[model samples]
Target: MSYPISPPTVSFSSIIFTTTAYLLKYQLTRQYSNARMALAPSAPAHRVVDVISYLAAHPTVELSVSDIARGTGLNRTTCQSILLSLEPRGWVQRRSDLRYALGAGMIPLGEAALAGLQVVDELRAELDTLVAAVGLEALASVVSGDEIVVVAHARLAGVLSQTVRLGQTIPFVPPFGIAHLLHAPDGTIDAWLDRARVKFEPDERRAYRESIRFAEDRGYVVVLDVEARRRFEQAVSELADRPASHAARRRRDELVARLHREERSFGPWTGSESAEVSQISAAVYGHDGHPVAAIGVHAQPHQIDPSRISEHATSVLEAADRVTARIHGRNPAMSARRPTRHV
Candidate 1:
């Protein structure tokens, strides 16, 4: 009845078969591509952890998602996923502006981590006392990765260093750099110095050697200028013979303790550009004679001189020792190794 049915140009069965085959092939290709992507080498987990740790340590920093991902060597998608997961766990916070930072979850963990780090805690009071006594800035710092972190700082009620604050990272350079070198083996120190490009050559090495030698002779090392170690030796020698009155020493220690309480009373440092001022830092060595942390006393260029610093060096050294003892506990063998001179 209908017009003669044209011989089916393509049979329904054939059409169905072709469509099915195409779909199957498409799906297979997609799955294969996905598998390859999955198998590809990805960013190392440790790198990711490093990024997270930095963010946790510096929470108030306004960092973009890409910035965070770049630090971790992760892609945006992956970093986003991590941020999302962390948000729920309260491990991190994403502001309305989408910057990520440490969250409330870190409070307990940070407390716990810090609880085990008694060196910082024990020295806090001493730092307070020192600031009060000297009417100068004082800092307690620890080595964190390749940098030093200021954990606590004390300033005379009116004297403040516009440069740094607690949790601020300080570059390891001369004076401060000496502490790192003191503990490192010659080869290690040499390599680091080279990498840091401090302009120290063979002669410079000899000078550094002489300075540290002098520092060892004295109870602490003091550098007068940026990257200068020559005065270190002089400072050490002065500290040895300089006589500090008992009353002065007591006053210094008490001030250091007060500074510690006041600085920490506010909470962890939240501001960016937490700058550190010019100061003298004494490296506190472990009972094993390893440099553990550094305690610094700061003042404006016009306010203090090398001679005054030498006078107070003894009290500062004692405070450093007390904190070190608490953190490392009693080790007769290790105790014997504590350097009479600060590194």
Candidate 2:
């Protein structure tokens, strides 16, 4: 009985502390295990979402399950399962050739999302008015990541009017995208150029620098003729098709250099059959004084007399100013200052 009493040296407080610690540890372990199981289900769902996003980004292209898997870096079987599940829900449609494209079901969702954008709502009337005044297509576009996305557009009444679809993503290249590059910061411009697989030669670099500087000073950039623009774009598309090899890049650079030289010599709006179309665009600035979007007017040589290009450009600048003022909630009077005309 005396020996048993000595065991009281291990106090009741110590016993309680040890038992409490053990229970706390057990509870934490159980919570962790449950959390891991709950999260495990999300992994597959995330992979499916990734597949949908990849397909969405390339809405025009029809891709097979293997292509989607390769693009999203998901297992083939996983992509197949996801696509199969989505097809039933009308989120995707599989073609007779087993290619998949975004289905009609996505339209309602897209419309709801676009309806929430204040800029789109505010610019709708302006775009419509500009189209009517210019007698040509008018487009509002913003830089989205590395591409330019057309958010809104108004088409003119003529058969020659350019047709642009909403939400169309265009490459950040000349002619179509020069307005954005003109207003972008120098570092951003450099990074965008670097993304092109083709390297620029010294002469090509100088020409681009001068062109951008000219646009920056004038607040707009002009595409002289449609022919030159089309040829250059065609060459660029060809370069994109080839593998990125040193020889291929060299060839691309050569083609670009030749185009630049030709453009310089051809002059702007010479009334040649090939040089019929001209385009002018002005940047729309946000509150930060950085350009967030561009509004542009396109005209045939007949529509805009070469002598009246300055006047047409002024109209575009005014439209762009209205957009800028609306976006930034600034006084419309602030944009009334006459912009310098550059032909």
Candidate 3:
């Protein structure tokens, strides 16, 4: 005869404690796994932003999935998925050749970003006044990181004008960029120059130093004539053409050296002939006493009589001051100072 076998008994409290412990352990493991996934390289949002940024940086280039993968360092499959997803939303468009580019959807986003800038809003009326008083295009720009971005502009009616698109990034070079550098803190300027690997010749370096000093003293920077403008454009074009490689960087240094040489020789102008064109730029300081933006006036000598450049410059300087005061919540009248004419 066999004795009946009974199962080992467990206490109700023990059972309850074991079950609760298991549940807690499971929940903690799940949370840890989720956090790891969120920060992983394969995170969906990170991949999407990487793809978009790659396209934006090469706006003119229509890139295939493989090209984007290589550029953004994402796997081809992920890049393709992102591109396909973005196509429906209009964030990225597919060309007939099946390459991708930034699509129409980005415009509204860019407009919204521009609308959010207080500086842009405050400068609108001042820009209009500046355009009217100087009879030229008036622009307000800010240094957004390492780039100069045009935030607002105004042009007088019934006059031919050059339209600088709002939210466009400008190359950090002379004429337009000098105002930013002149007013930037010393550390920022040094870091920017170092990143560019700039090696300036003695004379070119001296001229560059003087230009900054001149801008600081006069409260504005002037690009005297049309020829200087052409040179500036040419240098910018050359710099853009070169790739960001070691060899290209070497050539860039050489080109930058040449540009500085030319700029130093073409010092600020007090007056010009009736047919010449010139630019005046003044810094817009924030409440922190650091330059947050710059205001510029572009005038042909015929538009403003050569004798009246000083008056036009004064108007530009006053506009900049007014914007600065507005940013700091100070009275514009209390901040008024005599404009220092750049000779």
Candidate 4:
């Protein structure tokens, strides 16, 4: 039969247990300290990110101090204090009705931050896939200090003459440059044109005037360039018919032929000794529904003849939507060479 342990033995066991508990506590405390130290330098950016994340989750819903506090699990006073800090900077707005939403001023800052993050790599990779699938070229360009920088690009192997490279500057300003004008007030673009010493050809000038008026009317701009818009239209048109109708296939073939013709007229760029290049474009808006940037494609003219771009328009649009998201600071765009999650 077993007997109860003596008092001294029992005391020894209790001492061991206490020592083990203290050791574990020490280890856990040290680990937590290290983690806190690592995060300290990024605290402010983290807080701004937190604010942005909160806004993203609850867009278009009017938020109050208590609502924000409860949603973020912070104290009401703390929430109000943060909002106050954001207000003057135009990151958030307090309306006359006492409701709050994102501020108009926050847009550029958010866009700047998003651009700084290099999310465009993700977009380029996706575009590369599209190029292979469509047997054509896809590209993204950004306006950088008097040059259009082709930051991310993909092209089909069989096609040639696409000499565009990342970091290379194009003298021609992007058609979407008009966006800066639209976002500003009263002759801002005209003044900018004068300041930049830019002379617009008569047709180009008329086009810009017409485009700005049209964008204002529709609240957004969509380009119908041969590469992007034509492809999308072709895709939609193809989908309109089913079971591989002969008439539909014939129409698709015709559209593809048209794209080839456009490419030849537009190109000397695609290095192919034969099969010239064509391009198409479009633009989209933000949550506030403001036109942000233009999105489009460039491809070999012959590729357009089969309307092969239509087969890949969805991917092109997905990239464009991501770009639009970046414009509103919702996420990074593919053109910015930053890490962007798919929209």
Candidate 5:
């Protein structure tokens, strides 16, 4: 159920959500960004896409041949073959030490990639305005594979220091990423739940199914449990350099152990007068009925009066809608109140 939180003033400086001839453009734009970063394990052209994506995401580090093979789930021979073909073409550079990285040939391609981020720049500006207006830390991210990668963030010296670094990936596992998975296609949520790092009782699983949809309907997910969220963020902040690293896997396990213990932390708000919360995430979508990004606003690390929860959510949801409007997005009728899996 929606909470009785009071609305905030100055959530936006004369923000308006109106447009046309915008929907089609956003569908294409969303597709482009997803292609750039969010290929699932089962994506096609695995030999090329998986290796290229792994290298692109980890451009800061040079990797041994075995490292690339392990990271991309490719066999050693296939990985070696792909690298050999790409090294001559300059897409892959064999370092003096025999490790590899994106080569100079990727320079023009990288420049083009960065230049295609006008949409991301717009989202960043909007989030900046949002953080300033609400006086809270804020971030926006999009789904990539089985994780959400932070693309933009803004913070003030108010509540807490930044926990998760930009570009750090959070697993799309249960009890997290509810906001990102809200608009997922049929059965996708089921797959996510089935693959959860933490085990859930049947009751808990059923409730999560409903809660995700309910949040979709309300346009926001109230992130309660201050200490739990901080712990989760801190663990993520300390994650290994690459998500495929052994340390990262251990950290993901920590998320399930330390964070998911509080099964009561999320789900439909019970209208409690005070919520021990750290953030509230608002849903965002594209015109094609698929989610394009995730957005959230942070609050002080304490119990927030339920009325203040309402106030924070107003600004958060308004900012979300404005971002969608900027990109010509809408909640498709079919996706509304629709369950991602048949429970």
Candidate 6:
């Protein structure tokens, strides 16, 4: 048997002295760093960043300097100064009417950022394997600010799955984007719930919160279970499958408006029996531990097979871990085997 190694013991007075020395050193280092910062030229780069952020949020809208200043909470002169600096570099463009909007210069930076993400090809590979194993349409979506964009996918042949388009973007609405939202930074849920067109009831809000908690703890989210869920998924799936004609678009919008006013359809479920499982999603994390992607598998919305729920959740979790490894680490290794399926 291997003996437990013990840490070295230290005298009380020696510990006290060492602590004092460390405290003194820390104070001195902090003071020196603060002094250096104070002496350095102020770049006002943060103000520029805020302005760019504001413009990005309203990408299609041209704003006057005052509008930008109000949005950024910066003074008019400061906003003007920053815009002046940005205009020369083509970061922001001044319209003929003197209004400003985000310029084409940002395109290359956005392109470079997208190009730098070498995960797409690897993510698609993972989705293909996952779809094959789970026999459902497996999709990979990456978070982009307030939106989740489908980047890669593997759809099973002969399945009546909804068509998926690459680069399709969906807002982080309730009963959606939970796989990413569950691991999001604080305030994300509040923002998500608030984004709803209609205010949710207390029970509804609590249920949504619990669904996130379930996904957080269980490493997967179960979307639908009851027969009511089946009907709801069916309606949504029908909308998704609508043709791209103008009449279909208008009709879809009308139906979406009706659905938006209705109570959010999904939340956490607890049962010995299995859920219908319209869709199950697992989170993929980057090195920073923020959710980078969500790997989701769409089940037969009407099927209530209990066994597949457990099996499918495990497969997605494994796919998530492997995708996380390929993108964030050198080797494709999961830190742990997936938890037992039922739990």
Best lDDT goes to which candidate?
Answer: 5
After superposition, candidate 5 runs with Cα above 4 Å error: 1-111, 114-118, 157-160, 199-201, 226-228, 240-248, 300-306, 333-343
User: lDDT of candidate 2 vs native?
Assistant: 0.57
On TM-score, the candidate that comes out on top is: 5
TM-score of 1: 0.54
lDDT of 2 by residue, 1-343 (tens): 0111111122222222222122221233232346346422355655665565566545568999888876777779988999989898777889999999877655555555445456666566677677656566677777655557666666654344222434444455432466776556788667655654456776765667677766666667666754444555444433322212345446545554454445442233333333344677878776666667778875543344556566667778788878877877332233444554333
Q: Please give the lDDT score for candidate 3.
A: 0.59
Q: Each candidate's root-mean-square deviation in Å?
A: 25.1, 22.0, 20.9, 26.5, 11.0, 17.2
Q: What would the TM-scores of all predictions be?
A: 0.54, 0.58, 0.60, 0.37, 0.62, 0.56
Per-residue C-alpha lDDT of model 4 across residues 79-142, encoded as one tens digit per residue = 6777888889876788887767766655554344335424354444455554554555666654
lDDT of each candidate versus the true structure: 0.49, 0.57, 0.59, 0.43, 0.63, 0.61
Better of 1 and 2 by lDDT: 2
Q: Candidate 3 at residue 186, lDDT?
A: 76
Winner of 1 and 4 under TM-score: 1
TM-score, cand. 6: 0.56
Window of ten residues with lowest summed lDDT in model 3: 12-21
Model 6 Cα RMSD, 1 decimal: 17.2
Off by over 4 Å in 2: 1-83, 92-104, 112-117, 158-163, 174-176, 226-228, 231-277, 300-305, 329-343
Instruction: Give every collision pair in model 2.
Output: none
Models sorted by lDDT, best on top: 5, 6, 3, 2, 1, 4
- For model 1, the stretches where C-alpha displacement exceeds 4 angstroms are 1-82, 94-101, 157-161, 171-175, 180-194, 198-200, 226-277, 300-307, 325-343
How far does residue 168 in candidate 5 sit from its true spot (Å)? Answer: 1.4
Candidate 5, 1-343: lDDT as tens digits: 2222223321110010000002111222243335358623433344564576566556577899899888876788888888988899887789889899877665554335435444456677777667766666778877655666666666664444446445556777777788877777868788778767668788878888888877777767877774656666666655423323556567657766665547666757755665476678876778876778878876544444555676767777778777878888885534333112111
Clashing pairs in 6: none
Give model 5's clash tally: 1
